[model samples]
Target: MAAIVPVPVVDDLTSPGAQQSRPGLRASQSRRLNAFRYLVFALAAVFFGLPMFALFRMSLLGSRPGTYSFAAWKQIGTYPGLLGSIELSLEISVITFVLMILLLLPTMMWTRLRVPRFGRTLEFLCLLPLAIPAIVLVVGWAPEYNRIERFNLSGIMLIWAYVILVLPYTYRALSAGLNAIDVPTLSEAARSLGASWATVMTRIIAPNMWQAILNAALLSMSLTLGEFTVAYILGYNTFSVKLVSISRNSNNPVVVFAASAAGLLFTFLLLLILSYVGRRRRRRRA
Candidate 1:
């Protein structure tokens, strides 16, 4: 009233021009967000992918000047203990996975159905391994392993040791899968229909949690395949140990790179096959 100053209206705040500009502004923002996401993905790819690319390139380079050859790969078969180490590693991984499924799956399922209160305690026990260093674990096991060696095969002991290492991860995976499905309800229904405990577990629970089981198995295998410390410290000749020895002994980088590339490629293919199989089963179930 004093100055007769104009006051802004709400309508003026969202005028037709402003309304028209909003869609364009939103579209510009959306494009920018998409571009930023793509840039991040590209950067991430370059960050992780460049090293692998370089390793592959180095793997292809021949030991001699002005020459390129796959002698490194060819020589893998001739490495005295390599094939054995690979076989042994595969054996360990398979045995560990089987034992895990047989032991962990059933026990976890039972606990989920019967002793819900103890679930937290069980989880705590499983996670204790993560708190203990591998060196400490190996050191603790050394005396016991030496005693067992007198009577039982060390391979058996190795599998047991690996089980301890892989248990926490395997249990978590299975627990997640169990949680996703109504295991209690399923068990009740099965039991009402006169399904035995074994039948209920094998047919009902196992079929439903197939993906989780496979995931856990894959993780265990991957760990076993790449494990160097446990095997080395325990004086076992596994694939990783052999690879390390090769790297240390051979001056040529080609052999080391070739072996590494082979292992990486093989693991990729294995996972790819497993993924395809899992998808196929899912489609069938659907």
Candidate 2:
């Protein structure tokens, strides 16, 4: 009599309420997530790009209050020390590239691939370079080098300095790459098939990790090519040094702007190349 009470049956696979609720919930989540991503991207662009854009505008305006001209650009290329500085920078960057590879290679292999005590020690030591400030490094090296060695140090010192400075960047990249690969498994497989560690590293590991290595190289190249304090301290008249000298010594705003614009464009081009390669490599890896 109690009004013929009845119990509701729960649907196992197909339920109208569940099915209807899911699409709406999914749609709402997707919209919010997309909106958040867009917001983050916009904020990042504004934060990083706005200052560079401002510098570009300043360079365009040159020394003049309200006019634009190409005179600055002409002066930039035609400057007396520009070629020497560029060559010097190239030399430094190339040397740094070589040294960077050498320094990073072993660290990558040992730390992530081997993971032995010696490898750990090497990693800890390598990290010291990153932990020390550039100014501090320059200071320490200068006194000890000049006093003890009593030898003439030229741009080569700065070149090595670039190597030291960019070591941390390369190390992290390669280390990450090594971690991504199955090192111990690869080694045992190669060994069982009658391959030495050398062959394993060069043939298998290095090739697979090539993209990360390249990424590290590009980072070192970009950083070393545009360094300032170390070059100045070492008394090397590099491109960045000449650019700063030009800007500060005289009111040749046009030339300064042109030089800045050139530097920005060159770096941007390198960055673009690196980004494209990195993306392609990532996709291939995936």
Candidate 3:
């Protein structure tokens, strides 16, 4: 008689601790936080979601000016450059996402995996914008954004500003992703396996934190999309500016409400997808 058993192949990249600490909230914390967290989330739901709800209602019912109809959304679809503006804004956000990954990937590996000095300094540099007043940033960039001599006064300025403003949040999301992975062990093993630094980073590191990357990218995209002050200051009137302008016009109030509702709905859907991704990542690890 013989018994058959499957043999598991071990990759040197996995630390014993890696499987032990897959980043979903621990059960004890979940038990403690479930009610409190749900309460907090409910309050946040009321706070952020209510205004958008009002906007939707305003679009549909306010003024009885027939403004509450889906007509506004239809009209928005017909506007010249409207779709282009949305596409262009997305391009900028995606660019920012790529640039951030370029900057973050190595820095995180160096800090957590390679144990490099000055990593904290760079991290601090990335986080510096957190303290800068939005108004001040707008003021600082106002003149530069509209430069005639530099030949750079265009959509790029908008992209750069959104990217800059969103850097802190993006960095934290990605760095937390890094913290959740077995950076040192995986990287060292990859090195041992004759994988180059680039391969190790692109393959080993990124795939591990796909959820975090999604979260960061989505967060950056939403932030950039909704950013108002920078667009106003930069004179780069994209969707947000146009929305603001529409809101300002008493006659187009319905259009404003429709736009706000569409925007909120889109953001919430994107966040839901991100949450699903995080949950999936945890399940796969388990």
Candidate 4:
């Protein structure tokens, strides 16, 4: 029997003309995608940048028409309790961040390591606050504040409420971080090496999750600083509460706008810093 030789097959789609058109087709698609990306970026810039510009411009407006001054900005410190409210808000932000990290980090790590099955339930509980309206939360917290006031804690009591409000954001950030790393493997490795739980958490897990921790801290602090409803309902003079009070009581509208712009700028700076740090961390990891 004669063995027949196999014939080479060529796909029409891969013919010379088809091959020549493919690069042009890909180039066109690339151009369209880049254009779409630019369009999206422009829209985002307009959406976020416009309000911030208006706010800052309003803050700079002068008493007379067609004039501008920094008088309002200068007078931000003069408003009664303004500085104190800012200080109080900062304190609350710091305390709330610390408490949130201490309470949630350990619990989340343990749950992920020991009871992976309960992760969904744990996430649900953390995110439950997002479904609860701020006003409703305030109503529920009012009674608790009454008891807190008896101890003469004043504005400091807002820390607890702010922590609750920040939970959903903090949890999402931390959960993402935990998922990014092999928590169970790391924990087990550390344990096998005779490292205590404290050392494992601090020296091993915490370092790996720094980005997520920073994100959680930023969210907690920003929420604490900007929160109004709970603090107002609880009769605390937080930064946001004081901003409202100043807007209502002060004749100078620019002053209120100035304070608002300052707060917005500060939050923006925090975000910028977070972005910078995140970039640095990624570079280092790479």
Candidate 5:
């Protein structure tokens, strides 16, 4: 006869005690998770908020020691060509955004639908700008811009370079939107229902990816507004270039800091709006 062996019994998860404990365990985990999230948020606020606060405070510093005044902020308009440079930057931003949408949207959609194999190549070309320094890009573009100058297109020429500079950002944004949806299925279904390519793009696809498009547009505009290297090297006075010029030329350099702080605040506001809009859109869709 075989020797009798003792086996350990497993705890039954369905038992009343075990079932009652699970809710308590989950509640404890939820509390811990909420606490951790709040801690991370507080840390982030301190990290970002402190620098901005310092910048704003420094911008308000007066000429005398321990004095503070808003004169620097008010005197921003006194600087020659400062307003013009701002206007030029805004024009470049808007035009660059439109061109990016027109150029990238169709190409990306068509490529995804017809020539998916070339997607990697296209992505590589779009991302090539990130690897090449702005100075190097200006060197390559100088000759072409010189040619363009003969046509009397002064600041307008910057639009071409701006579009290329913003490629990596816009491409990534559009790619994220594309990846979130079934492009082929959507395209085929629309086509099967007698929808034209234009209809498919403008009506079916573009509407669904508006958030990504808006994100790309805002990024392109922000980059254009803050871009210094390409515009400076190419001899254009964009917003960033204007700020640099003011810091170097003005006796009261505090004004430049004030303007910079204002620009930063504007960008932050745009980001906040983007977040709010995205959240509202998601809720509506849900």
Candidate 6:
């Protein structure tokens, strides 16, 4: 009678046999890490998606007899002032975004090139907005906005106010992009090649910092679209103000739910597209 016995293979650290197992061990570790990453991603998706699902369900609520429906969603068009509010929000967002780029890009580049020391001062001023509450800023501008009404300009003040609100974010984005490149060197090279300051900024500097520019513009647009306090205090019927007004007056959650869901969807898509484009640009550069 014979019994079969197992023997362990002890790998010596300096042995070629041990080196052969290294690849297998590393591969196993990689697989485990990837599995953990996927698990975390799935959990995060659920964490963020659950509320959106609940909101969507609410948007479709009261549509039928114990049946889920989207009648409320369709009624978004019928909602009073809904379309006008959306249009005003879009107008402010677009105008503010344009002003952010035009007003900031040149000044940022000029500061970096002409007076490097003032760069910190500029950044400090930009961060000041974060320190001041939006309500306080709105209150301070109340008198000026009142005067704006005398001129019949109305909500146009919102565009300028939004530029101030969006400064902190857009400045940081532009500063990060500027810090990545040598501004003085780029400017000198462009000038030596017969480029005007305008040409240098528009063609040379802007192209290099396109990502920052895009980020700033999109961030400005996002902020403008979601703005409320200033618009409300100043008596402008921007989208967010209208949403709150409707929710307060109608006491119907459906319109609120529908608008929120639509806004969330739009924001998500905008961010997703930006992320994809940035990744593709990085890949192309690499």
Candidate 2 has an lDDT of 0.70
Question: Candidate 3 on 1-286: residue-level lDDT in tens?
Answer: 0011111111212325634334687878766776787899999999988877777777676346544456767756766556666676667777877777777667777676556687788688778777775777778777766574277645755766666677777777777778778888898899999999889988999899876777677767777777777767666667777777666755656666676688778877886666666666566878
Residue lDDT tens for model 1, 1-286: 0111122111122234734344655787877877897999999999999988987777777767767777878766777788788889899999999997898888788888778898898888877777776677899888878888889765546888888888777777677778879998999999999999889999999999887888788768877777777788878888888888878886764667877888888888886777677677766877
On lDDT, the stronger of 4 and 6 is 4
Cα displacement (angstroms), candidate 2, residue 153, comes to 5.1
Per-residue lDDT tens digits for candidate 2, residues 1-286, read 0111111111111223444234556777877877897999999999989888877776677445788766666776677887778888888898888877876696567555566667767767766765677877888767655663357545655766677777666666667667768888887898899997778888878987876777677777777888887777766788888877877887654566667778879978987766676676566766
Overall lDDT per candidate, in order of appearance: 0.77, 0.70, 0.69, 0.79, 0.80, 0.79
Clashing pairs for predicted structure model 3, backbone only: 59-68, 60-68
Poorest 10 consecutive residues of model 1 by lDDT? 1-10
Indicate the residue-level lDDT of 101 in model 4.
92
Candidate 2 deviant stretches above 4 angstroms: 1-50, 62-66, 110-115, 144-153, 284-286
Candidate 4 root-mean-square deviation in Å: 13.7
Number of backbone clashes in candidate 3: 2
In lDDT terms, which candidate is top? Answer: 5
Q: What order do you get sorting by TM-score, best first?
A: 4, 1, 6, 5, 2, 3
TM-score of each: 0.84, 0.77, 0.76, 0.85, 0.82, 0.84
- Higher lDDT: candidate 4 or 5? 5
Record all residue pairs in model 4 with backbone atoms less than 3 Å apart, i.e. clashing.
none
By lDDT: ranked, best first: 5, 4, 6, 1, 2, 3
Model 4: per-residue Cα lDDT at residue 83:
85
lDDT for each residue of candidate 5 in 18-99, tens digit (9 for 90 to 100): 4423465678787787789799999999999999999899889988989999987886677678778878888988999999
Cα deviation of 204 in candidate 3 (Å)?
Answer: 1.8
In terms of lDDT, model 1 sits at: 0.77
